[model samples]
Target: MNDKLTRFLFEDRAVRGEVVQLQGSYQSVLESYHYPKPIAQLLGELMAAASLLTATLKFKGEVSLQIQSEGAVKYAVINGTHDQRLRGVARWDEGLQELPTEFSSLFKKGVLAITLAPKDKERYQGVVALDKDSLAACLENYFLQSEQLLTKVYLATSLDSAPKAAGMLLQIVPPTSETYQGGDNKDFEHLAMFADTTKSNELLELNPEVLIHRLFNEEDIRLFETQDVLFECDCSKARSAQALQNVAKTELLTMIDEDGDIKMDCQFCHQQYVFDAVDIENIHNDNFDAFNSDGRIDERTLKH
Candidate 1:
């Protein structure tokens, strides 16, 4: 599959790696909004990173990578589930003459938040500064601080008519033996050195197997089954109706009176859900106590 992820382990070393390629799913996210070139590129890289990070999860839930800032690009987030399903969205300041190329310029005081949301357990979130030049570098810094493990992340994206993104992650597994002190492993550094040689074009265009072989021809590696990655959004009319519950009943009635119906658009997928007065009445009458459990904002106010 063009959109798939593969996991591999170094048999003789305490290192694990994952490779992810995205094309169809990447295109789907771009199609939902007319994003600027830089924003589109950022989203692609985030998607790849999210996929790689999601594979590291041992639970049945999703991982979200979010960047919040006060600069031109105000907010951006990509959510990826354990099964590789993904979706993303971004918001930026309007009327900007040009978008900045540097990460710091685009996001003043920006912080990257990595959140692990489990299906049945409490969610965990870690934050790191966006001081690095690229997302890959920021992620590496995160691994060093939060995980205390050496990690190498390579992310590449092509914003062509058919957008594509791919990434590789190599990490030193936790020490299991007394000899393996809490630090970088020699074998991991060796493999990471080889992985760093991969060019952006090679990552986006080469097959996963061929790329792996080219990077570590001498290492004994065990490749696992490939998992498909898809662009999926869970926003629905019912969910939109449920979201209306967040608004005050008087406000809902006022909106319906002013427009004859209240319209809600999903920020992620741009899907529009319209609710008439009758729909609003039923929504209030129904017992949807768990409406906000999903934590999805179905109604977004347009900014001038």
Candidate 2:
């Protein structure tokens, strides 16, 4: 099945919606690590949420959803761009015997943060406490607190065999003209009822068209063109080397002396990058001149 996100608007009500189904992209993320069952499922939901949230971006940069806590699962994060490319990672305590299944139990005193980093403008961040039972609820709370918009989010994941994730979102749109009155609680509630009835199996299996038809066959839904979603990591040797440049030279030299080289592993894609003495020296002396005017590393300079 194609992993895609579909957006739609209700002609009769001042509300918009988004639905995303994941198959290949979700599986690609799981293949990178042997995450525990609960953690895998949580990551899947976060990825789905990230995709849905990124679809709302009006700028040309990336957005990230992160959950941090001092619980068994230390942290989980997913990043996505306006184009729908996504990547995620999760970290947890080692040798934990029991993992809580509920969000409150698993993430005691946790915080959920959404960050928007526009390419040309200032970045914006909004944070909320993880006081809800599910990730979807926490996201809804985020909208309520930050945007003050009546929004609803539904997320589901299945890791039985082939991992997959799906999610749907609905938010009331502000009226633009006198003819277009703002959405009321009654209209939002009526739509939310249908959304709340979505089953995990239906979400993971059905296509967006079929899913929307099944749920809102009575409503006037205007479906838009689907957008593809994929598991994409932006990590590269150049980026990794530039990151090394931020380190103290003495610390890097000590690492090189002890290990003969410094190795860096991308937490998102698990790709390993090795920097030998020559690579380190070249990077140190170039003063980042290896980077071209376009901000991309000149690969030819690293060959020496």
RMSD per prediction, one decimal? 2.9, 4.2
- Cα deviation of 125, candidate 2, in Å: 0.8
lDDT of 2 by residue, 18-69 (tens): 9999988888888888888889999999999999999987778999998899
Model 1 ranges off by over 4 Å: 175-182, 287-304
Using all chains and alpha carbons, the TM-scores for the candidates as numbered come to: 0.92, 0.91
In the predicted model 1, the residue pairs found to clash are none
lDDT, candidate 2, equals 0.84
Model 2, TM vs. native: 0.91
Give lDDT tens digits, candidate 1, residues 124-216: 999999998999999999988887778999999998668899999998877552333337477877887899899999999999989999999
Candidate 1 at 93: error in angstroms? 2.0
C-alpha lDDT of residue 140 in model 1: 93
- At residue 182, candidate 2 shows an lDDT of 29
